[model samples]
Target chain A: MTEASDTLVEEVQARFDDLTILEYEFDNVEIELARKANALNAPLYKRRAEVIAKIPHFWALVFGRAPPEVETYIQPSDEKAFALYLDTFEVIHFEIDDPKGSPRSFSLKFGFKENEYFKDKVLEKKFWFRKTSDWEGLVSEPVKIHWKKGQDMTFGLTDAAYALAQAKKRLPPGNTDKSKERALPEYKALADKIEESEESSASFFALFGFVSSWRYVSAEESGKIRQTEAENLAKVKRGELVEEPDSDEDNENDEDDDHDYQETEVFPGGDEVAILIAEDMWPSAIKYYKRNHDDDDSDDDDMDDVSVNDRANENDDDSDEELDIRALVNKGRKEPTSNSPPMPPPARKKQRKA
Target chain B: MTEASDTLVEEVQARFDDLTILEYEFDNVEIELARKANALNAPLYKRRAEVIAKIPHFWALVFGRAPPEVETYIQPSDEKAFALYLDTFEVIHFEIDDPKGSPRSFSLKFGFKENEYFKDKVLEKKFWFRKTSDWEGLVSEPVKIHWKKGQDMTFGLTDAAYALAQAKKRLPPGNTDKSKERALPEYKALADKIEESEESSASFFALFGFVSSWRYVSAEESGKIRQTEAENLAKVKRGELVEEPDSDEDNENDEDDDHDYQETEVFPGGDEVAILIAEDMWPSAIKYYKRNHDDDDSDDDDMDDVSVNDRANENDDDSDEELDIRALVNKGRKEPTSNSPPMPPPARKKQRKA
Candidate 1:
């Protein structure tokens, strides 16, 4: 064996010993452990065992599965990390982590070098989250990882770590407040305009599409907002709540405040709030233009052209970095907020059927 | 109003009356109904009510919402069906069904024209299944329909009909005997070959991927098969059950019979069985080839070339049609046979990490 291969074996061996001790300690404390103990151990044991098993599997595949003269090197970086170099073109990194104080909780990261095997053959990165109740010793359903273009090589690894951390409520340092406040009057006015508009059902839906594509609001959330606004309007008609209709001066003041806030507040990852504000104002702008041209039916064509041009300019200003913000917003929406099963990722705009 | 619009109103009015009768009949039979009455009525009432509400919403969005000069027409085809033609290229079809005997059970189909409004805007076709017990009148989680390329526009409608029919045990006529017999010896041989192979952890996983992609076997089912095979092998080792190892002649006879069976049996919808058989034999074929070439290191390159060529040939023979069969197989595996929450769809192959 090469020196690198020797180091890999030694490193894996050391981690294997640590895992064994952890398992033993877990067994001893089984009775005293909390309910989470089982949850933690379920993934931990499976991951550690998988990592240990992968060492021999990697070697066998590299040597026995491939050509014999295809030179390879394997090395251990630390007790918890190892690397496999497949000639000069490819490398595989394997890392196993069990945060010091967490029992029965572990994560495994397997990194593949971007090579022919990955480019043409490998489709997705998969991580198994073995359920604690799987007594049959079968690996449970896996969590699949899809690599987006321009994603970092360690994207899957970091995501796994983040998922585990979130599960354990130990997520990395970040601002806890992610929620943004909406100006109720502005939302109410938009809802009213939509209700009164002579635009076709198709146009109404098109407006929704523009909003969803430009803002953080999901299709589901947008529906909820519409329903809420509708219900609130009904209540107002029934005199169930006092209405404080804002004057034109108040509305202008609110818009200026919103614009200033959008300019000043930099959302850490993306400007979702700014986009939301922009989309929230979009319908009003159209309504204003329509009211001015209400007497001239022929002018509708000019209105459409203007709006299309404006949208094109907006697209031009929104860089790829900003587009990625939409992905982040989608990810944030997927995080489970309650005991309920996570709502399937917000339906993509491309999948909508009117 | 035009004659078409009058007919549309008349048809909807008739269905609305039938729905009202159904609701009243349901109320009369409430005390005699089983506990499942509530559960059944939950989605039923909400869907019925939404359909009713949508009538006004639809009319308002069509005539009231659109420009007066847009030139629209609406007509009813039957008591339970209607259509709205918005100009030349756009049409919307609405259908409501309450199979005569199934009280408090209904389905609504909303069809959209494949116009500009739909082209770049519509994503998922959504139907809300609201529970009657929900006092807040919040729309429950929506059931989304994704249209596959070349799929019928009314696929969602037909699928919903099928689901309701299945629930009511009123499915359309067809031969019901769908189960196939398993050839245990072949499975045992395959399992034995995998266990004896030196391909390590990777081989074991390849075995799983092969099983998952090929058979109706789930991860859980694969685990059970492995456990059973391991135990049987142990018993054989201990000289318990007579091995009755197949002689060369017996193996040849079995192969001939298997080939004849494959030629005769036809699977409805698609030949999933044939594909399964092909994929099931894939790994074993590779293993056999590898075993034969094991002693000669220089032959490795040749083996790789042969395997790659074989795989390419297989790919050429397997059309997109058969690839879709794999998806269907995975879907079948996800549907729980017993009383359990439906397992999420099988993780797609593109999402696999390793």
Candidate 2:
């Protein structure tokens, strides 16, 4: 490989490796799909296989083993673009052809559109990349990529970048350390507590499935959103901010309003993430009920003070920052907290997330 | 208690016992919820408790033993109605008032509406009853007793009756059979097959969950529906029935049209059933995919002949009647069989049953 090609390969490999970590968290779903392939719809398995094939180092990154013999080649098309081939199948085309003068602007053409599984589903497949220092102000952000002509199909690459950075942060701090070891001490402690509790291992697995399935935001972003909301709630309880007028009446006007706020566009393999969550998250979901029940028992006067302090404490705990399993497991109880802002009613109508 | 009240209690107990059997089929879900109660939403548990409480022999039937010390009193409100009091709380009011003059006509008023958990949610709480000869031509159908003004919310009594009848059919037959034994040899054989197969016990539990959660129709009705569809498909293959013009173009006009065919209303405790299915069914679902795959391998010419013979043999096997778990597990491979009818695409959307 040439010098430029080597650099490109390294960058792609790094990103692919990070995604593999996320994929590991969702291994239960993969196993389930593989086992149940015969019982499930044929088209579903086809779709899943197609997505897995798109990522580089698929087996090594996902299964933590050497991949089968698969040849890959990088051919430079022009000064602004290059094509990436996997086993004679062109997977992606990277292009820096920008009409507007922007900093390090580039676009990725996901070239597997010709694959039978995706041919009819995807019209145009491309993702745009732009640099931004927003993740802890330490890493660059990639813009949401738009694909499919006349469609609002986009996925947050910024979220993916943030997720990867967060995963790296979990490793023990060290320069020039490329060990596969992840999962901090705090995470281990949390898992231990879950195991020690009356909850089954299914709950723990379910929580992992839920985390891996978050598509609109990265695990880091989801955690940040929860933390921010909790902090805001604490502030409101402390009389630092006034509460907005309730929107319950407006929400009642639209029975299907619960779906209105969901991200319309999804990333590749997003549907699979949702399927995993649905299949695995039920046992852990019981935590929300328990928290709500506990909240219901405490006197309203003292409960508010306790909740506010709890929220504040959570914000300060950096070790348990990203994708706080405890918080995610308990977040559903927010509806019952006396001082917490009223959330919209739970969706009465069943919604099937694809 | 008077003789009439004794008879009423016996009747209620019989039906309640049948329901408890159905509940036992979904025991995995109950245990999961109970274990993870501290992690789940409080309202969910409250709702579950309420449903269980609605049945007269809830404690005795579920625990398979005597219940806790609780007072219950029956008082006739009039010749046509009676009130049932449990621990100074009116739980149900049985009324033999039917303006339509239906045979064996009665209504049950679930009197716990005033409880805080149910106050805002249940606008009307009543169930109607009518005589029916459907279950071996021998039972009565329950109707939805319309109590609330401007509301006609009701559930199918026939479906419930059919479900009870089907459960009875699964039990070994003998005169004066009062042994607590359920599950005929065929059921045991199926369960043994599942246990011996590559699938986990969870998958077996999940199949039960799926069967129990089906709304709009009873287990018997669901079986009948599938059988009818299969027969229709067979006729279509035989060129006895004309095919409808392909509606692929119409379906393309609306991508979100899939949900239009789903049943809008769900049975009570439907959500719990769905949770069970997601948590447990993955391993067994593989059988369907495997069957479909095998079917794909066979040539189209003799495949039809093989399928017809398979279907004919299946019809002859009386022991495999009812919801054959093996057939349900292996149904996905229907494509290769010429006599097998085509099914709609699998539901890709994750629908929360409740």
Candidate 3:
């Protein structure tokens, strides 16, 4: 390239870089917008939770009418667990205002009455807004659900994941390298078991065991790393430290492929499912509850499709539809809809219409 | 249903209705959020436009690298017009603070140097946020371009649309009914010509002739209708006027089908195209301009795909890539990229990779 052309190229690049800084400013404004929205929404959500608590089977029916993204992950066995014990569902945007964290970080909490299914009164799973060298988004660690004998709705996926987590916890602190984690006996056992298991239908209960394909980093740890990186960048600019271009190569070696995750093991599409529940299902719980009534008042076609796996859609207006009997003794429905042997609700009904 | 069950249903419905009010409140908060963000962004965008104005062929390269939603509309002929004299483009959200209007309403202004395509130095199209009885969205009227002899890029579509608009303007006041409008000679002529024409590709220039699938009502007219509706509803509640169940039926009769819009005449996906330009193209023009440079700096694969219809992708860094020769006589690029005959830039290149 000629000197004049090179000079022109540099001028263009300078303007482009300036615009990138502006884009960063735009992103900061977006983050502030999210914080404001979250603050305004918190009180509204609290009031909604209070109102929904009075309606029996509110969470159960809400799950039934959830948008397909969430519905697709639910299996028949999970529906049975939900019908028996599910009381209320709540989503918390726990890091909306944290400068070091992200607005996308949230926790999904499920309240359940003591039932034959599990011992826990509340199960909470948290997804953290995290960043790796090349990627940035939500990442979650597996949650352990202590299931009763023969009541493990996820088969053995959750158990395996939990056991692996315990074993990893015992590893030397800095040995949390993914290749070393994969080399653990517990991790191998889980991987082999996942391979041996048939390609069976997934249960929503399996979602509790989801681990993001991206390496999981706690928000606190990520914040520390970011602080150090910024400090080092400043130092390098001041000639106090040499810039290390090879650092990226080190991160690349610990790539996600080290996990060797199977589709079922990692819970495919889990992030989308979590987001849909947090943003749509939780906020629109009343609409979903009303849908249960709409389905009853509208047609027998909607009512007839409730089977074991589809227990979420059962004309639960009767026994199953009632809020957990022990939890809401006086809130049961007076009359369940007409009798219909339940089958699975029609899959992708809207897509079929299109 | 038993009376007890009926009472239960009513209770449920009451709670559901309360939740709907909350949903409406949520929507209001969203509107306020948009207002706040737009205020913050206004100055940032103004500064950006100033920086970009100094760059040569900024608008042309930005349009070339625009997302597929906008790119799909541009044809070879339209690209030639853009290459020749498309000087600068601006998007203004003209109704951001209008109490009765919407933030979605905007005007796209194109400042062009003297060119063969048209006589106007500046062409502007405004899309208004409108509401009909059944629909609410952005709608626009066709713009007339005084084409220089033999330079009409839309192949008569714009002429037909503009002529129809003129004819409609002459209709008796309060006789703007669609059925009557379609009865006009110009309307039928366009419809018949549309029917007889073979399936032909479209030009982006033709988008200036877009009409919404929903009936077009001016923002002022819509505001008046809303005010009158509110007054009527209040009068009915006070028993000053009897409620009319047939009002909706009257609206249904004036439904969109009365216009009998063919897919091409109304311009399929015009609303989407308008929104993409306003929200994406205008804001991200710098990223797009950088992409043109990236294509040149990278490899032969990206630079070799500029054809007549694809003139936007031509390595114009030499001649066409420079700012319109007359507008910025001294602002020409020093070196154009390596030469190869340009084909239409690869269609949906990203999708092809997938």
Winning model by TM-score: 3
TM-score for each of the candidates: 0.19, 0.21, 0.71
User: For candidate 1, what is the total of clashing residue pairs?
Assistant: 13
**Which candidate, 1 or 2, has the higher DockQ?**
1
A1-354 per-residue lDDT for model 1 (tens digits): 346534543343233223223333333343233233333333433433343242222221222212111111111111011122221111111112321122222222234344321232222221111211001011111223343554323323323322332332332333222222233333333334434432322110011111111122222333333344345445534434323223332122222222322211111112222222222221122222122122221222222212111222222222332233233223324552321111111100111000
Best by lDDT: 3
Ranking by TM-score: 3, 2, 1
Q: Place model 3 in a CAPRI quality band.
A: incorrect
Q: Give per-residue CA lDDT, model 2, range B1-354, as digits (tens).
A: 246544443343233222222223233333333333222323333443443343332221111111121111111111001111111111121322222321221121123233211122222222222111111111122222322343211122223323433554566552123232223443333334333432321211111112221212222432343344345445533434323223332122222333321121113232333332222221122222223322332333222222211223222222221222223323344443322122211111111111
User: Could you give candidate 1's per-residue lDDT for residues B1-354 as a string of tens digits?
Assistant: 346544543343233223223333333333223223333333433433343342212221222212222212111111011122122111111111221122222222234345321232232211111111001011111223343454323323323322322332332333121221223333333334434432322210011111111112122322333344345445534434323223332222223222222111111111222222222221122122122122222222222222111222222222332233233223324442321111111110111111
The residue ranges of model 2 lying beyond 4 angstroms of the native Cα positions read A1-227, A236-354, B1-34, B38-354
Q: What is the lDDT of residue A332 in candidate 2?
A: 32
* Regions more than 4 Å wrong, model 1: A1-44, A47-54, A57-354, B1-230, B233-354
Taking the tens digit of each residue's C-alpha lDDT, what string does model 2 give over A1-354? 246534443343233222222223233333333333223323433443353343222221121111121111111111011111111111121222222221121121123323211123222222222211111111122222232343211122223333444554566553222223223443333334333432321211111112211112233432443354345445533434323223332112222323321121112222333233222221122222123323332333222222211222222222222222223323434442222112111111112111
Candidate 2, residue B90: CA error in Å? 17
